[model samples]
Target: MINLPMSAPTFIKSAEIYRSLRKKGITIRKTIDCLIAVLCLEHEVRLFRNDHDFLFIAEHFPLRIV
Candidate 1:
């Protein structure tokens, strides 16, 4: 188990990601998913998720989805 910190910059980045997705006509069902995606992106870690929303986020960001 690991504890990932969410700082002000991370939260700002998450909101930017959400806004970017929205601009592309993609609507993420949950805000937490955006936060998680930002964390993975910041840490350079691949995210393993079954949620379809991630596909959209992955497309816009450099998020590695496995």
Candidate 2:
């Protein structure tokens, strides 16, 4: 549970999310943020962040952020 693995499907899912969000005009500034968002989406992990970007992302994508 310490080291999170980034496999092929993970990256693929990330790309998919990026494209979907992009199409919706939800521009995420950082690639890492997109990756992390995808990771949480896929794993059902709740994210605790105070960043506005994450709030915007959560609005479009289903994420439990606090």
Candidate 3:
């Protein structure tokens, strides 16, 4: 079961985004980066991250990582 605060809707969206990226052959080495990207994409939030993985994610997805 998903955490109720962020339930099925959010989980489904995150999973879908992740799957789509994977299907497109976008390889994100870090799972945390993928998770953060999905959350930011879904919520339209900026991510101030120094990890290069986040930069990779931003290139492929609509995530703003600093």
Candidate 4:
């Protein structure tokens, strides 16, 4: 398991991601999910998730869903 730390840029990116999704009419029930997506994006880490929320995020961002 990797321990990834959330930084200021991560938070900023997460907000951007959340707002972008909202503008696109995609509402992620959990805000934390966006943060998680940003983490994977910024780190170039592929996410293994079954949550549908990740699907929306992956559609826009370079978040690879494995």
Candidate 4, residues 1-66: lDDT per residue as tens digits? 778889999999898999999999999999999999988887889899989999999888889998
lDDT of each: 0.91, 0.78, 0.68, 0.91
- Candidate 2 stretches greater than 4 Å from native: none
| Per-residue accuracy of model 3 over 18-52 as CA lDDT, tens digit each | 67778888766766666667667766777788787
Q: Write the per-residue lDDT of candidate 2 for residues 1-66, one digit (tens) a residue.
A: 434567889888777777878898888777677778777877788888867777877887787788
Residue 51's C-alpha lDDT in candidate 2?
Answer: 74
What ranges in model 4 sit over 4 Å off?
none
- RMSD in angstroms, all models? 0.9, 1.9, 4.5, 0.8
Error in Å for residue 36 of model 3: 1.8
What's the C-alpha lDDT at position 39 in model 4?
Answer: 87
Error of 4 at 27 (Å): 0.3
Report the Cα lDDT for candidate 2. 0.78
Weakest ten-residue segment in model 4 by summed lDDT:
38-47
Model 1 agreement with the true structure over 1-66: per-residue lDDT tens digits: 557888999999999999989988899999889999999988888899999989999888889999
